[model samples]
Target: MLYLICSVCLFSQSTGGIGIRATESRGAVISPVTAAEPKPELSSDRAILSPRDEYSSGGNAKADRGTVGHILHFSDVHLNISTSRNDSESAAIPTVYGKDAPITLLVSALAYAKKVLPKPDMFLFTGDSVVRGNMTEEYLAEVVEKNVKTMAKYYATSDSNKMKDVTTVVGNADTNPGYRMNLTDPTTEENPQIALIAGTWQDSLSKADLDLFKRRGYLAYALDDTLTVLTLNTLPYSPSHEPNTSDVLDPFGQFAWLNASLAALQSAGQSCFIVGHIPPVISSFGGSPMWNETYIRTYKKIVGQYSGIIKAQLFGHVHSIEFRLPLSCSLGAQFQRAGVLGDDAIEDKADLVPLFMTGAISPIFSSNPAFMVWDYDVTTHDLLDFTVHGGNISSTSGTVDWQPLFKASQEYGVSTLKASEIVNFVKRAETDAKLLEEYYFNSKAQSRLQSDCQDATCQAEWLCSLYWFSTVRDYDACVAFTTASKSNTTTSTTSTIQ
Candidate 1:
């Protein structure tokens, strides 16, 4: 039954878009405007601001006085070293649709990021260093080392040539067999896979962090006196993960450690960003859960307990731009697992942490390669805004042109990337045709690879995904309600016209 439902959902996503017309031609670049240039009016609902207007606002004047910090985030490079070596001649350009990224593409992306934000406060790479495939353990280690060194080299400080502070999580593909990790007692013995990856990251991590990561494939890096980044090894929680031990309740003792760490952070009055490879939510691409229900429930409970100190949850693996709000299921609604609920079941917004899924640098999913530069309040550790820069891979010319795709603040018209603001945007998109269409276009980083969605079921899936529905029954209810509402709206409009 689950397999059948997943098959149908996958089909819907593959054919889904918001039926928004493409304004720019394939590979067309929009020039950045200067401060002197007159700002364009928001005449059309589909219209978005130029890169200059989007970012040049400089946020709050007080923040401009140097209280703002920037973090450069990259994810899922998925470098295919085999293809890169075999096709050295064409390695200067980005890889085409079906293949993972080549060495050239990775270098190009890092170089572009360096050029744009040379001195970001911190660097974040949330997983998958190598492409997914069968390979010898030695060869996999070599690939991982190369990917790590490449990033370190690019972000090295100009003054001392030291590698910048980089926080990374272990993706499923980082191991020999994807989504498989050995469950060993960290104190008594070390996991060979985690040890190998830790060796490559030695330069970027502290001695304590390296030791901890070597043992269990997770670490907490203190970014500042008030801010820390907790990078998790989420493989054991994944549904696709291969079971290696009988202790399913707490794989590698990650949850207990997580709860303790968060509690410590809370006691110290410091905030943190929870970074992980696979998120603990329903996969928006397919109507399936990313982690097992047990892990998800445990994770949610821990996060909710420490919600006051968790700034945001950042994840990769989705390979697309999207976010998940706190699950707002009421007490009775949570237990009632079989059917859709009435409108009152939708609870009011709460101050739960918001999860931001970063897009991939690999175009393997037919998504344009992209990365993000995040702005935040230095004192409060609040996420202010983020700008996504995308590289358009041209099929005919076989080259990638990098440009700023959109800034979250300007595109969504939100003051900050808060959960409440994002929730409001989701509500607005439900009825605003132009806003919904614009969001659908940006969701894929403006790639034309997937066709526009014309089906109502597909459209509902896209919108409800933002809410992070934990159960299929809840997700289905949201979809059914949305589809019917749209139908009624259309009918009412038509009758008025007559």
Candidate 2:
């Protein structure tokens, strides 16, 4: 069984030294920047810090100059087109919990985003546009095209009437026979699955990117002169991938390409956001590694090498909102040995790369359908803040009512959505029950499916998951520590009662 563990030493919070850290890298200093304008307050029952308070807080440094860009991020639509086509007139078809999203819900979600969210400079879709099931390749292509066109229509700029190019990563369910992708070389023998998606996304991808996608199943899009978004095809790395490609060391040569791309970006003095469908971490739900061990190791090495230039690593296969705090294996072991605690433990923030996974728009797993809008510093590409908008499917009014669930910076009391600040939030939450509960609620997108995480086992799992464990052994060590800590706490309480 998979388990998450939090050591007793990891529970203390230090009031001092708890803000974003500027790091010196390659003879240059990289500092966190905040949005020039404050985030608009959205109505919510939970208390939120005012925009004025957030800017004045010592944690976030407001940018004096630089554009603030908004990005709309959506993932795992899982549109069940067949169900919608068959039950066209029935409102009940859209509200069912255990099934993939019907067409009505998908359209409503996109339309709602367009109406409510700020106009985005860029849009992102992290794969799984089609539902998981056996179907002809023709039908599969049709569903994917429908999803693509629908997104294009909603996100099209008013002046140009053309949709902004969407940065996308291929999800496991996007291909036929979910989790299966032909291992043949794309240059020699075309993978029909790859070809289908490339053709469907022609309008959403540049000609160069389309050709690259046809050949390599991945591409990088330049957001500006200084920033790029690298969308990875993570299907081949997943442990559950079909056709048993375990013998293939570097499937589709993606690792080599990735390493080379990041190297070039680093040399060019440009930063990037790495986006993919599946994240390389121990799954909180399954309590197992999501990617093959070999792949995870190589990926982590590449990320560590370019940690300075990589702004964020975004993924969405879990269909839940969560983050992984990056730490080198050696550093994690060192911390574990010394029982490192407090926000001051991490001295160099560059060693930490922020890994965030957004919640899904599909209610298939009983998680409320959700999407997010991110405010980022255009010049530095630092994530300033983000608001998660979720729709409650169990609304008594018989319709999903979408609203702002929470804004990360305001809700978590962080200045910027940088690694250091998030690490501080985690440390503080360890000792604050109220803060931890708020995180638990947001993790599930405020869905009815979420249960109270009052037990030691559940709390430990959630806390430990925030720290990256490169291998199962590393994860097990943390688990053991947490288990022992819980045992000791229980014994102390029992002795007090006696």
**Candidate achieving the largest lDDT:** 2
Q: Rate the local accuracy (lDDT) of all candidates.
A: 0.67, 0.68
Task: Count clashing residue pairs in model 1.
Answer: 1
lDDT by residue (tens digit), candidate 1, 48-130: 22212223333323324236677788999887776334546436644787678888888888887777776677788999988
lDDT of 2 by residue, 114-176 (tens): 766435667788889888788877777787877777887777534553224464578898888
Candidate 2: RMSD to truth: 8.5
Worst 10 residues of 2 by lDDT: 22-31
- The residue-level lDDT of candidate 1 at 315 comes to 90
TM-score of 2: 0.81
**Candidate 1, which ten residues in sequence have the lowest lDDT sum?**
1-10
